[model samples]
Target: MNGPGCAAGFRHHTRYARSMSGNRKRILIVGGGYVGLVTALRLQKLLRRQLKRGEVEIVVVDPRSFMTYQPFLPEASAGSLEPRHVVVPLRRVLDKCDVRTARVTRIDHARRIATLAPHVGDPYDLRYDELVVGVGAVPRTLPIPGLAEFGIGFKTIEEAIGLRNRVLDKLDEADALPYSDPRFRELRARLLTFVFVGGGFAGVEALAELEDMARDACRLYNEVKREDMRWVLVEAAGKIIPEFGEELSDYTRQRLEERGIEVKLNTRLESCVNGHIVLSDGTEFDADTLVWTAGVKPNPMLRDTDLPLGPKGHVVCLPTLQVKDTPHAWAAGDCAQVPDLAKGPGAYCPPTAQHGVRQAKHLARNIQRVMQGKPPTPFKHKNKGAVAGLGLHKGVANLLGWIHLKGWPAWFVHRTYHLYAVPTLNRKVRTVVDWTLALFFRREIVSLGTLHSPREEFAEVAAESAPQPEAASRTPGQPVPKAGAPKAG
Candidate 1:
């Protein structure tokens, strides 16, 4: 609720009352992440001027006021892009819609009410004539012995930037200590070792780019060498990059191995007790950073609601995006398991950003159709391709079939597609600028440790240099007056 360091916060209830004239039919939206923000924007554009006729009002609720461009996160953490550019202000962009920086704690489909926990105020229930469930997914973490306390999830922009700083900070700390001391050197070696647990896009791309960045960064350090840093990517599955199919996954593994990254397969992290990575195969290594991006599950809030869910806790919907056997209720994004008509089997659309974006547009039209007393259209989409950037000018991609691509071309497609798809033109320009600058300049690895405590350095310096009681009023290089004497005056 302490809104992710975006523009502070605004209380929209008072402002919205002024817009209400107390009659527009309300649309209450939950979860203002990617799916929520896009859906609300489309609804606002579609339901324009209806408020004047008291026909429609839209309210969106989320814990934060920003929608994170998740795809750019790995690049941002690797210093390829600025962290600020990856997050868009939801309230500023969706001003016409009532936006609340609150999280929905519970939902009641039968009563059409959503219980929410606002950023500052007490719990309250919002009633709406129409509803949308875009409440996205969270990082699927396991109950590893010490994971909860030591592991970091790559979800929010803050977390991404924090991870970047934390990673770079470890480097700074390790190198700060003299390498002549064995204990200090061992600590430095451990800090430089990074462990990534997952073989999916998040894990692969993150491990690849972050490793690339750290390798490049080591040149600046006096004693730290690229060989001293160990990047271990652990996958429980047999291969990496499942989107690329088995052969390409093998290619990915080979590419990582060529770069001296250890790709451990059929492996599980036994324990990270005291920041040491103990493996299931009796392999042990000391690591200071552990990243978790393995997978995602549907929002658990669905269990308490009356809406019917599929096998995986997803809201069971027909071809149309409407809730099964329910009226005026809808769910999409990762939360609803919309049946994939294209797959021919009982396949539901996999929760990917590509599908989520497409579904949002169709959903908007469907909602508009339903509002106008027309039948809603079914949601169906065929995936064209999947691409991932694995550092500055390296990657592997599968466009249609097993048509594999690696190196510069794959990386370019990854950037170009994400640049076009990420939200507003302002953000698009910023992302372009990030890439453009990448061409002429070197990526900076300096960590601004002041972010953790801006005043600690100043406080320490002040304590070290502060004048004694007898010299409190003295000027630099000037003789201090004695406590009881007139002194130099």
Candidate 2:
């Protein structure tokens, strides 16, 4: 807790004395992601009286103020859903709790203090009686050549929308060039080619959705044809969406091939230097877009805490979702290695939205059980299968291990399930509205890349208007020269 400005005074306050005097217990949640938001919501209902009587306090902290519904990311990127509708603003929903838009730099469980680094102000320590660690996992990346320089990740809302604009902009670039020239053809091919690494749900869904959108957009362009674009999916594994089993995996691959997508199995990307991709199969191609969605690793921030972690760096949690050997500390979601009692011994819950949602509710109940001096129940839930959207009116689903759905039926199920799963009623209505309007109208293919750098044009104008040193030093009789005009000797 020792720091420059406020740490000395903050350390002076004893944790026990503060709780003793106020008769209030503070619950600090380290993240505002899936588990964090849901846990806080459940706690509000379970401990409503204590919260109203000022007997309990809940604090949620995260860098971003909104919780993104990740399942709808592909649709958002493909313009099927509005970008704003996919992200729920935390402040609006968790109105009862104190939401802090900051990052927890470190956690000291032995002292019950968490160091928070705000966006603007100084870093400070926060004291809490109970702690919930749900910081979530980050995209697992490899140290590949040129990967960091020219790789797009499909995780957050910003990246999703940005990728959408970039794809459309590439189409625009290709359309502007003359088709008769051979040099322009090569350049156009590069611009139109899209490469996605990893055969997981994220890579498949993103590649499929964007390719469909780009194909539809080609109808309006005179030069860019659907055949001119190349959509390639590179996976090191022999199968895609392996969790869905071999039957669905083969079906998915065959379906993607029918749509003119190249699915390379047991392939690895050796390098992508300056947009030129080199694969392990000795294939080389120039591309303008590369998206990496290989896998995810536990949040590296967990190493800064005093809690015990598994070999994979995830916080080890018992069947009750409590951190092992640590009382009053809980964890779940992608960052915690929670024992999957439903799956039996040596098994852990997979990092999926379905499990995270269920774990949050269960973890909230366990917290209440401890408060009531009752033994916490073990967390258990049967696997609900998996569903994925490929493109407009195309999908695949596996329900209850016995039921299999494909094409439009699976697509409908995907949409319906996610609509029911999205956080708030407001977002659900807005998403449905977007889908309803899409039925009567065409998809908007406009590229809004300027959103990234809105001030570029203004900055250029200001630089042009700026007075030069020579102009400033000129005599009073000398004429002031106009910008970009000839200079007098």
Candidate 3:
């Protein structure tokens, strides 16, 4: 490991020596996503002795302080789960490690330093002996017109809750207007229309869950009817959820269509300027809500580092999960192109929660081996199948290759897998409580959009109570008149 770059990094400055004083080595993990969080948890247990004796240090850096469990986001958006229970706070879980709420601006592996920028403080440099890159992917957006200004993404917990508010608020606004009014004909239709541009799990599941919730909500409104709403799903590929196998993909499409959703396959979105959509199939319409979940790309921050990257802007990793030809640097998850040893020479593992959790454990064990002057082992995990939920009691799952289930059976499996996967026993209990309570009562349909602008009312009151300027009739040296006291004519 003592190559030219590695040696220079050690000798670049005295800060490195200061950080390593008393033989304590710092392991810097650059992300707080699923992989980073899991790796830190495993390492804290595996290196318990070193951490206790001040011989090792682990630091996790991310802009946000919590790690979101993304699989349950659909349920949260549909009001089946509370938004607060969908994220795991890093500080509460990693008691033995240092958790820094900051973003990594740049990485200089040649000097073993990383630049960090917090939300409020100035940027500073952090030195580390071992590095892990797990900064995950961002939404893959197209150059289509109006997408940046109009489309919403379904990535974070905040976004999921915000989408819920937006949908319910739209229904409320449309219900208050008169449907027979000619002037509101087009506006009412726009308010009732919802468009989703993606057929992947995130897009399909979100649409299904939200649609079901909205349909149930219609019963509470006297003016709103379920038949008046329009739901359209547009996919560029010939099929939706290609990873679910051809048979299951067809089944999912049929289920969605049975619920009055228009599935447009082999079609593309041309434009959506000013809420007017024009598709590649010449279907033009007006909609108030548009969601983009097409795909995701690797974090762009990798370009600013000294690591060797793959052609698709991902860090290249060998089967052992080490950055190709770069010592003391490792990467996994969506940001790294880890060779799939289970699939043979030319294949790579798909970016999913199943692969990520297993890789994190393997990487943690490998790091301990390297620290003890032992060789690292390769990471290998076979693909387990995929499961997805559609609305309330409908779903589909393909386990291994021979086991196929649909409807209630698949939905139950979907819930069972994610519930078992969510970190921390505290969170698992809270989530289960939410689900249990939901069985006796209907899902909440109230929209809390005011949470976004809670200070607006206070600001308005403050503006009205502000002191008024002195009257023009008063002398220059005289005392100024109080607000609302009296005004000279």
Q: What tens digits encode model 1's per-residue C-alpha lDDT throughout 407-452?
A: 8988888888899899988999998998898889999888875787
Candidate 3, 1-489: lDDT as tens digits: 346654455454346446565568999999998889999999999999999999999999999999999989999999999999999999999999999898999999999999987665456688889999999899999999999999999999989999999999999999999877888988889999999999999999999999999999999997788898999999999999898899999999999999899999999999999889999999999999999989999999999999999899999998889999999999999998999988898999998988888888899999999999999999999888999989898899999966889999999999998999998898999999999998999998999999999999999999887755544456778776577877555
- C-alpha lDDT values of all predictions: 0.83, 0.93, 0.91
Candidate 2 structure lDDT? 0.93
Arrange candidates by lDDT, highest first: which order?
2, 3, 1
- In candidate 3, stretches whose alpha carbon ends up further than 4 angstroms from where it belongs are 1-22, 470-489
- Error at 384, model 3, angstroms: 0.7
- Specify the poorest-scoring 10-residue window by lDDT in model 3: 5-14
Off by over 4 Å in 2: 1-21, 470-489
TM-score of each: 0.89, 0.94, 0.93
Best by lDDT: 2
Model 2, 262-357: lDDT tens per residue? 999999999998999999999999999999999999999999999999999999999999999998999999999998888989999999999998
